[model samples]
Target: MKARRVLVALAMMAAALPVAATAETLTNDMVVALVQAGLGDDAVIAKIRASAGHYALSTDDLIALKKRGVPGPVIAAMIESGSQGAVSAKAAFSADSPDPLAPHPSGLYLLSGPRMVRIDPTTSNQSKTGGILGYAFTGGIASLSIKAVIPNVTARVRTKHGRPTFYFYFDEATRGLSQAGSPSLWLSGPASAITSPNEFTLIRFDVKKDRRETRVGSMNLAGAKAGVMDRDRIAFDYEQVTPGVFKVMPKADLTAGEYGFLYSVSAGAGPGMWGNGTGSARIFDFAVHP
Candidate 1:
């Protein structure tokens, strides 16, 4: 009788165990298989929701899903499900609470810096195209000026995982171009001097559908002392934390997407504000992982 009781107890325990304990974790291939097996988005999402395991997704995984005719919303559901093992997206970034990824002023340097290190031609083989301008005064009566500039270039960098604040460190070289004089001086100074903290704006870069990009929001400088800022333009709040160190605080948590900073020549009044460049902007691209 005692032996029979022990056997029954063991059998009950086994029955209570979840079947998924022996099942494989979720994967892109598994999702594809399910879709091919005629499962709908609702069904797929339900399975993922009921499943228990971390989903390790890669760039290839996303591309594969798109290629396999998976709807973007469905793919987004998969990513959200994977990103938050159990927590919801809203819970992940609560509006009332301080962002867990918020950087400490002292610790900002550890995670923030210039993504594009201006390369010296002597140090690297990176091809560069740009030159200086010249002005000639003939007979001290009339003057001839020559202008030359390269097309805007982009730099790609990955965002520090989970960090919401962006830090920009200006070495002596960057400050001379962007910082130094007051905002009023920007118009009269060299084009290089057009780079101000307010000149920075966040943008979204879509890799799919012809690699198009768009501005994230319409931001403007509110508390600036001097500058030609438009309320209609997208801008960021900038502060000089130290001599050459600056931090840009976004209005809200950045959603999972590909984003970048645009350095606009029309950062002040508007297009052709500087009367130099054609209001073209330099972009520094980055990705926010889910």
Candidate 2:
């Protein structure tokens, strides 16, 4: 009987070993730090470490990580490459670097800076395009309006089994047609499948353009429509662009003027806003310029 009891105890201990071996011994402080650090899930850590590599991180690095839900400072500290750091920092400082689109933080922002003048580039949760998106610009003296149909661009998504839950990406680039001389939305919200939204939103930025101190302009647009179902957004902006286009210098060439900018847009809610649509805003010809 005693021998039989010993054998049973041994079997129970063996059964418990697997659970103990597989368990991850993480401390509370460690878990908290990881979360506060924006470690998110285990997969997030791997992706951050992988793409970040040995590169040193900066504000742009943090912005890139923001798209990934990682902590900004942590990402900034992790960048190991100078080129990557510069690239990411540029994104961080430029308002044009992002626009609203699909599942995640999809909100359109139209901005113009020295050398980097990108047009409507859509930011979305994923790739699901069915209709139009909007763009607004803030300039020194001009209020511009823009509209066009969103084209479905390929998006990067994470899957559980085979189902894609989240997507992140930029839209296809749009070409500039003849410039409209007045403040207007060149196109209504998205109208074409393979094209970019029109450039209709604008704000005159010349009020404070010449000041050595940084200047800002704001734009507000509202009551527009998003191409997807139930997608709604209200976009506001403040901008200041140097006068010497394409010149990245400490002293900005403002054409010597006192300028102020205002641009804004409000679109009804759509599927693109909350994963209700088939695709998301990738990016567009969203622009800010001279």
Candidate with the greatest TM-score versus the true structure: 1
For candidate 1, the TM-score is: 0.31
Model 1 ranges with Cα > 4 A deviation:
1-155, 160-163, 171-191, 215-235, 265-279
Q: TM-scores of all models?
A: 0.31, 0.15
Residues 1-290 of candidate 1 have per-residue lDDT tens digits of: 99999999999889878763577677777777887788888998788777654554678878878898776766887887765653443233221222323221111122334232211111111111112221122332232221112222322434555444555543322321222121322234233454345655565544434243342222112211112124323345677665544666666566666656545323223453223322333444555664
lDDT of 2 at 254: 26
Predict model 2's lDDT versus the native: 0.30
- Candidate-wise lDDT, in order: 0.45, 0.30
**Backbone clashes under 3 angstroms, per model:** 3, 101
Q: Write the per-residue lDDT of candidate 2 for residues 62-169, one digit (tens) a residue.
A: 565566554544443344333454455434333223222211111222222222222333333322221123232232233222232222322121111111011111
